[model samples]
Target: MPDRIEQAKRALRADLRERRQIVSSQTRDAAEAGIKEQLDALVDRLGARSISCFLSTPTEPGTHAFVTAAVARGIRVLLPITREDGLLDWSVATPETEIAEGLFGLPEPVGDVLGPIAVNDVDLLVIPAAAVDRHGMRLGWGRGYFDKTLGSMEKCPPVYAVIFDSEFVDDVPRDVHDQPVTGVVTPTRTIALASHHA
Candidate 1:
């Protein structure tokens, strides 16, 4: 059954990837600006002083502006550093932090590496997603990095997945190890899914 679920996810991800690639530059710019605004408002709404956010890849809804602005605002932002062992290390983000291509060609920060457990202290987690369902089931980009990180947390914070406005769906295939997020942040709005309080 899990295999079937994974297969469905694979097919869905392929379609989503193609969709992202075709987003016009004009739309992309507006989306990025909107995403940054939503993220900033989310931070203020939650009163989060420290958070973890992923550096966006070019095709993903841009988080680069948000990350940079957050650092300048004196918020502690931890960026994910992919490790070979299928776990994530982290790095604190600053205006001076340099980005380099990491595992799977993902954008990662170059700096002092903080171990996996470093994320436990964060007040919020803003992560990547290929798509997320209304119930908060996130379809990641065929990688288990975020799932593993989220599942192992002792006391997970208000984890939110970042995606384009159209990536939110009514349902998605999920397996036992799949973790539901507290909410989702899209280019246009933020949704605190009901399951966040479950």
Candidate 2:
């Protein structure tokens, strides 16, 4: 029998595939609004200076609104760079920074790449996900980029999965190595999960 994580992943992949195919402009607008509201609330709750979030891409849910809100609040922003051997390095993004196409057509910074910082330094991490559950489990695009990078961190930041409200579910299949998030942000509201391990 497939484990819980496997089942959830399969379901989520199907949902995301369907969503990708027929995402109407109206749907996109609504999702953007919802994401913006939740992000504003989150930033307010955890002051701007205390958060460091990853810049999102257009193909992913909650991309533009989240980044715009973060930037407007003067919160520090970081974008992931695909490094040698499939590793990810994050560098700060500024107003004048130019981005070039990187691995998988992802946008990366054109300025000097910053060295890796301790996860503890980031009070909150807004991660993009295909799907997220109420329990904070996330299903990524299966490249293992986030799992690998986050796995090596000495102190994991408060990871929060950013998704459309429809992408939030009751459960998702999780494996031993799958890192669970502390919360999920959707267009509607922020779903907080009680720390499962502590």
Candidate 3:
């Protein structure tokens, strides 16, 4: 049964990946702008002085503008660095920080590496997602990176997954190890969903 669920997730993610890649540069630019505004507003609404967020891939909803803007606003932002052990290391994103491709080819920050525990101090977490159901169940890219991090945290803040508006769906495959997010941040709006874990 679990294998079948995993298969379903893979199929859905493949479709999402294709769709993301096909998005026009013009549309992508508009999306990034909207995402930046929504994220900024979310930070103000949550009063998140420090936050952990991923450096989005080209296909994903872009967070680069928000990260840059956040640092300029004096908000401490931590970017994820993937580790060989399947855990995420973190680095503080300074204006001068450079991004390099990670082990998985995911864009990661180039800086002094901080252990996974560095994320514990964050006031909020904004992560990438292929899609999110109304109930806040997230379909990740199947690497289980975000899943492991969220599960290991002793005290988790409001975790919001960044996704395109069309990616907000009715439901997604949920494995036992999967973690639900507090809400989703899309290009159009930031919404709070009722997550069992939240």
Candidate 4:
């Protein structure tokens, strides 16, 4: 049986997911463009030569455009290839990298598989989240993949969660297993939270 906190988190995650699912195509497109712009600014600010990114699905705040653009600019882009154990294996995501059906029906890189700690080689890390709070606590998609990854990093690079502006909230339930992000990048705003936990 799950704890009360986990149960509450599941409810919240479900609600937030439903909200994301209803976003219109035009709105999603506009948000995607805005997110790409903000992401570019973040890359410039961090001077990140190599970064870990995700390939977004259509409904999520888009990362596809930003990933491709970053690669074209000579930035090394690492994308996650989910493994059966719920930990991520890293791979270089190029414009030509083959996209194949991956775990959870998401598109994943079909390139050389780098081990889990491959993320440590990057200067910055960007990940997906269902919601984020002002305190930097993130609500993930009820799976512990990223939480495990971030928790195990000895020296994690600056981590940011890509989310829609509306999904940025004041309160998100967190437990010992939950991981806090360094910041959140929304389409219209870039919010940097004070250090809590990486």
Question: 1-198, model 3: which lDDT tens digit per residue?
Answer: 999999999999999999999999888888899999999999999899999999988888889999999999999999999998989999999999999999999999999999999999999999999999998999999889999999999999999999999999999999999999999999999999998656
Tens-digit per-residue lDDT, 55-164, candidate 4: 89877999888998999999999999888998999999877998888999888899889999899899989999999999999999887889999998988888999999
Best candidate according to TM-score? 3
- Give the residue spans of candidate 4 off by over 4 A: none
- Alpha-carbon lDDT of model 2: 0.71
Q: For every model shown, what is its TM-score relative to the native structure?
A: 0.98, 0.84, 0.98, 0.96
Give lDDT tens digits, candidate 2, residues 1-198. 456667767777887967866877787778778877887788778764645455555655546556655766687777677776766777766666677888877766777676555334666777778887777778887677777767777877677788877788787677777778878887778888865521
Candidate 2 vs candidate 4: the TM-score winner is 4
Which lDDT value does model 3 have at 73?
A: 99
Q: Model 4 — which ten-residue stretch has the worst lDDT? A: 189-198
Q: Name the regions of candidate 3 deviating beyond 4 angstroms.
A: none
- Local error of candidate 3 at 81, Å? 0.3
Pairs with steric clashes in candidate 1: none
Give residue 34's lDDT in candidate 4 (0 to 100).
Answer: 89
Best by lDDT: 3
